[model samples]
Target: MSQPIPNFYAVIPAGGVGSRLWPLSRADAPKFLHDLTGSGHSLLRDTWDRLEPLTGPDRIAVVTGRAHRAAVEEQLPDIADLNVFLESEPRDSAAAIGLAAAILHRREPDVIIGSFAADHVIRGTRVFEFAVRDAVEVAREGYVCTIGIAPSEPAVGFGYIKRGSELIVDGARDASLVERFVEKPDLETAKRYVADRDYLWNAGMFISRADVLLAEIEASNPSLHAGLIALAEAWDDRDLRGPAVDRIWPTLPKIAIDYVVAEPAAERGRLAVVPGHFDWDDVGDFASLAKLNSHGRKNDLAILGENARILSDAASGIVVSHTNRVISLIGVKDIVVVDTPDALLVTTSEHAQRVKGVVDALKLTGRSDVL
Candidate 1:
């Protein structure tokens, strides 16, 4: 219900094959482009919906692969073509987000930029906005800020942010200094993290002044910062932009934003976290996909795609059918069946995380057509 944050721009880094969701998610068409929630909307559109209220459509930008440009533009017709940055090839989060920061900073140095993922599903927009408002306030104070999700369960799939003392910032009462950024841990460590009030799930939501973000990047990784600056300088000139990207993008270091800035900033006491009370899910794997859609019940299951007939007896799993072929299940539990025109994936929810290995094996067999 609050007004949009002034001068706050949002950048969505929409890259990732989501190989764990193999067959259903491919290199050309990733999961972000799919309506995995069965809500009749792609995750990218949902993300735009969540951020549009905070920054408006004009202030939002998206960075994705060149191959998905048409699809991204089709889904987000409101987004201006200039706001969409296409990578010649993959360059990881550091380059994607850093390039965004560099260009936005070039346009408006005082701009507060927030980098969010495209594939996350979130509920409770009001809480989300409140947390983002707080993060913006923290960002205004010259601190690199991130919105950390309040952990609902002991999730080992996500990295954890340990909160230090509470930070005192106007409009950001719940803000806290980040103690450290911890990587994904074992089950026992994750359980302890859940029990401890100091830890929050790292949802990859970073907010900071565009200039400040670039300064941090310059301090940590000078070569990457230089490349981003070069590309950003040429961003406005249509003729030079393509040549700049083609030449500089491949030469930039391939590193994630976490390693490039978050962890190092946390160590220097420059990183802060605003705990988000909203329901958030990255939908990393099929098990998470089941949870998001509220599927995998003992008697009932989730069926995605139209004109797909399914019959089940004592079955508990999900079925995603792209074809009209009837799928039948008997006495099966936690199974995931994905039927496509070219490929079909049948695995249990228990073995869902290992689905990435399947993609790796397929790659070894030179099965690029299915992938």
Candidate 2:
């Protein structure tokens, strides 16, 4: 079946190795390839499942690295081969999203494009679909729309979006003008944000008409926009695209889409946010992952994989088993234990944020094999 909307495309920028969930989320095989929620499908595959309802299976594009190109191809075997945009190396979100927008715009002039992170988790499918439907409506009226998640608690882990006045666009009554974007704040600031009725967690999911998104970029960062235009001209010709991107992709600025596009667009009154009441999480670390799935129990060992034997006596923490091994814990509370064939990680959920530092330490010792 085709999408309900006439012309729409979904762009998933699948970059960044999830270092915090190390030992399981490695460099060669990143977080998106793993099923963090035990949902029976890879995170990347789950992403495809989520968007295929709104924008048919053929209307989606995945922007990933050269190293993981084969993995992405293997995982999403049914997607159009041309829709997988492989970069020579990681040039950050601005280039990735801009390139997708530029190419899609060239083919379908009025297409509404939405950029979603490949590794994010969303519950309440109907709620998510409603938000996307509204977001697409908001984008059609020449606004850069973001799906702002409603805050459930005073969470310091995510950046906040402060919404302003109400928007009166058709089919988007819940849309609000974006007041401004805030960085990840301290605990107290986050508490105040949750207390305030105007704040929502920034999920980094944006929707906009391809031409409008490119126009905003052209006004702010002309060079990057120009490079995207050059790439789009060669996209249809397979032989010409590889050499063109190889020569020009590395020269594009290494910046995030938030700083270069969203924030500025908000300041200029070109940004709109559709409130999403669905449960959402980026799953940056194991501590967060514990909360998302059934692995965050305080009274028992939270086991993620099927091949694990857990015999605990007053021991409570998260356990992820990759190999067929008996993981025994006795009276050691709040400890994080992960057993893999090559490496094992042991830490507490309180210090779960420091797992990325361990990845850095491995880099210092040149442990690329495990990475």
Q: Each candidate's root-mean-square deviation in Å?
A: 1.2, 1.6
Give the per-residue lDDT of model 2 (tens digit) for 1-371: 43556677999999988999998998798999998888888899999988889988798899999999889988898789879998899999999999999999998899899999999998888888889999999999999999999998898999999999999899986999999999999999999998997999999999999999999889889999999999999988979998998889999999899987899999999999999999899998888877776533556667788667777777777788898887788887777888889999999879999998998999899886787
Q: Score candidate 1 by TM-score against the native.
A: 0.97
TM-score of each: 0.97, 0.96
List candidate 2 stretches off by more than 4 Å: 1-3
After superposition, candidate 1 runs with Cα above 4 Å error: 295-299
- Worst lDDT 10-window in candidate 2: 293-302
For model 1, the run of ten residues with the poorest summed lDDT: 291-300
| lDDT (10s digit) by residue, model 1, range 33-60 | 9998877888999899999999988999
Best by TM-score: 1
lDDT over C-alpha atoms for residue 362 of model 1: 92
